[model samples]
Target: MVVENHVPLQRLNTFGIAARAMRLARVRSDADVLALVRHPDWRWQDTFILGGGSNIVLTGDVRALVLKVEIPGRRLVHEDARGWLVEAGAGERWHDFVAWTLQQGWPGLENLALIPGTVGAAPVQNIGAYGVELQDRFHSLDAIDLETGAPLTLRHEHCAFGYRDSVFKHERPHAGGMGLKGRALITRVRFWLPKRWRVELGYHDLQRKVAETGITEPSPQQVFDWVCQIRRAKLPDPAVLGNAGSFFKNPTVTPEQCADIIGRDPHVVHYPMPDGSVKLAAGWLIDACGWKGKTVGRAGVYEKQALVLVNLGGPTNPCTGGEVMTLARLIQTSVYERFGIRLEPEPVVVG
Candidate 1:
């Protein structure tokens, strides 16, 4: 119920962008959100929900009342022969939750280990990695309707999950679907980890780990460890180098489009989808454009992985969100000009 003014946000966001929130509140429970919505002085429509701050780019000082979700808890809600239903608070760290599930003998989320952001934010972005997505294990979620202060429990169908997308990502209703965007604040999420656990090593990196370790039938913990190792090696730790993980989502194209791109550059990395579409690696395109280890202002493309954009200026002199976007625009333009595919940024850009 307490709102603070002029909160520093440099460390809150993984990108380490220098910004401030005009008004901020830490949401710890359902009651906290309800109280804020019913507050006569505060308008619910003027609020913004923020979670782990791992997947956002703050363009400037935030004028909206920032609800920094800090709700916490994790427990086994139910169990049956089919699966285990696990629930976690919206604010729980995603990686920690994934590890906790594995330790509890629930193995469905091992491949999603080491991803940034909170559990609540996971569904919002439909976060995926190593061939496993949140939607694969998602059961349901509890959220507060910011407009009416009513509690809501939404299932997978209600979320409309897609590749790095969900109904929560849209601010306006489109295609006969109502968008929750700014009108909802997730409080808790439940996941169903099936008893029939199966390892997902379809990603090239995981396959390589299986090959190198000679552990073809790796356990969940081993998969978790390998994923953590692979991520640590490929991504810059936010604590050390400011970044928002992969800057762009891999673009999916039709078979003909893929063939055209292949004809242009025979070595373009891509994967065929079950739906008959082809997903091109965004990093390879950027690297092929010769952007690796390059910089624009204080923003640079990670030399090891071109999909990631980094803040070259350390904490003492951080890169502004403007600089980051500038670099992203340049990268997008380059890739589009070369391959005729438009690259879309994955992070939610907020000003």
Candidate 2:
């Protein structure tokens, strides 16, 4: 129930951006949040919920009250012949949770290994990798409304999950008009891991691992290990070089659009979706635009992967959020000019 002032945010965010939260509170449980909501002096103030800080960009000092979620726990909620329902606190690290599930004989989350951030942040971004999205294994979640401190439970349908999207990402409601955004604070999340586990090697990286290893029937642990290896080889560790995993979502286009791009550059990397749409590789586009290994104002495109944008200056003298966004906008402008499609940023911007 302690509220602190002038909290340093450099260590909190994976990007290592130098910023300060005017006021910050660490909420380890639902009760802690309720206690804060009932506090006389801070009851009506605007609050920002922070998870692992993996999916955000800090442009400047955060003026609002920051609730740094630190809740913790993991348990099997229910089990049946079909699947096992597991619950984890919002603050649990996502990659560790995935590994823990595998050790406990739950094979469903292995493909999502090595992803940075907290469990609560996963649903916000609908985090996905290697063809498995959080929505695929999600059961339900419990959250506390910041305004009233009232507990709320939402099922999978209530989340309104989409490609790297959820109700949590939208500040304003869409057609259904039920956006949660910054209004609710997730405390716990439950996942449905099926007993009849089938390995997901749909992504090109996983397929390459299988081919390279010559292991046709890879176990869950093997898949998890492979994912970590691939990510390590391709992505720069945040601890060494500050970065937020992928900078942009893979843009989807119609068949005609794909054909048009192919006509212009036949080597363009793209994938055909089940829904008849084409998913164009954002990295390939950025690399094709000659941004890879290039730096703009201390913000640079990763040499190994163009999708990732990194802070060239590191923690000592990190790039400003303004520099990162400037580079992002420049890349977006170039891609749009070349492909006639806009690339949207994946991280949430905080100021």
Candidate 3:
């Protein structure tokens, strides 16, 4: 575990924001993490755990000791008549792992295909797509406590997964006063894929695809391919156009609030939740407020999908985190002013 100095992080993050890590260490195993935590010189230093760097915005040079997780492995740990239990190292690419699971006949994660980032980061954000959240198939995860230098295995209930949130997203003082943000380093993640799998085509795009292709009962690989195609067309490729996928979480509102907004604007897009609340389409709100194709200092709302904020300038002149935040705040203000619902950013912001 060699600690490097002043590592450029422009390519590391999906936003392509120019920044540097003051001190960075690549951790490839549990021993490397233990060694870092047990080291007297580095034990007390502030540290940031980095996975694939797809869900973060670097505002400035990172001052914390950056632990870049590189642990790599994938295997079917257990299989029975009921389902399959698959385990993967935290550093494994999420999309590749999903594809691998499909190839192995573990067909549950097809809806979440094509998402950027590492498997370790999935639980932190409770990443979801097309009505399938990680918690739905999560079995357990192993992580190391940064403060105590002890290992922990957490189950579904222990994670406290919510909409785009988990215990990992908050600090100790927050999250019901027991949050684990920055306090745990995930080593491995295990998924529970049922043997009797069912395809999830609840999203509008997937339904549209089914209508266009006339495939009523699609296989897991077909679903995966469809999701990939939809995402590729809607969201800009991070390699070509720097972005962090969806920029905002779809804000949920009470039924009364939804009715009020509907009364004001009849064309408002919303979905009724199981709990009687209404989930407003944030992208629709932004587009309604005329934000698509808008730019603010090299940062702009994606033309294809208003939910995505992209870097207008290429790698030669990338958008700074400040500019991205500025555009975000402006959109938030507009959406709140127009719809009376405040938009929340989805990505983690750090410096």
Candidate 4:
């Protein structure tokens, strides 16, 4: 258990925002988590649960205990002819775990190769890329209720996953929902892998990459490599620079709205949604407004990836992290003005 106060979160989050936490605690085991939750001093205030801080924006000082979920363990919990099942400690670094699985010849997690953040945060977003999502292979999870400190098991239905959201993120806490406010904190994630893989080519980019290779059957590693290569070219590394992977979730709208946008701008990309809706590429809207690589001062859009917002150096807004908010508002306004569609931010912002 590591405890501290007035911890500067700039170095912690990928956004590099200079925010402060009144109290911060790191837990490496379920016991530590329970202890922290039961701690008399911590039980009375609003708290922020942190993992890798990849998808969070700290706009101001957090006057609460910033509990970082660090419980660490990984093992093969089960295996069968259909697939080998693996369980991961929520606190484990996600990308490293994916690499470990790849090394072990696991087939389920290959397409999620280089995504940043902790394993715990994966289910909050039902993280997807290329043609696969974490939920597609998820068996279930173990989460501790923050209030009662009791361990609860949750299956896929309980997760309420949607595009870039789950009950943990989009919905309110156990208000008959899966949000992690008072009664939820993920501790373990279970996966079901395959003995023989089915190569998912649902996404066009993945299909095009495979088409170029002139192969129908590709090894999991080959598919993984291709996805990684594309991500490398398209996404900026948040380590060298400061950025959350994607700044916004691609907005979903009615087909009629999409058709109207397409009529005006022929290049607008649209992915048909299941229930007669369409998901638009936010990158297209941002690029359409010529916002890519555009910056005000300290905050800027990533040069390579239009979806990413990077902090250049010094303080941006000099006020309310307004510069960062400005970048967000610009993308929102421009997209709305151009296509009448609003791009929603992906990161959780603490104001």
Model 4 per-residue lDDT at 250:
82
Candidate 1 local Cα displacement, residue 7, angstroms: 0.3
Better of 2 and 4 by TM-score: 2
Q: What residue runs in model 4 are displaced by over 4 Å at the alpha carbon?
A: 170-178, 314-320
Question: What local lDDT does model 1 show for residue 69?
Answer: 95
How far residue 194's Cα lies from its native spot in candidate 4, in Å, is 2.8
lDDT of 2 by residue, 148-174 (tens): 988999998899999999998777884
| TM-score for each predicted model, relative to the true structure | 0.98, 0.98, 0.98, 0.93
**Which ten residues in a row are the worst by lDDT in model 3?**
170-179
**Alpha carbon lDDT at 3, candidate 2:** 95
Q: Judged by lDDT relative to the true structure, which candidate is superior, 3 or 4?
A: 3
Query: Looking at candidate 1, what is the lDDT of residue 196?
Result: 91
Off by over 4 Å in 3: 173-177
Q: Give the worst 10-residue stretch by lDDT in candidate 4.
A: 314-323
Error of 1 at 61 (Å): 0.3
Alpha carbon lDDT of residue 173, candidate 3? 44
Please give the lDDT score for candidate 2.
0.93
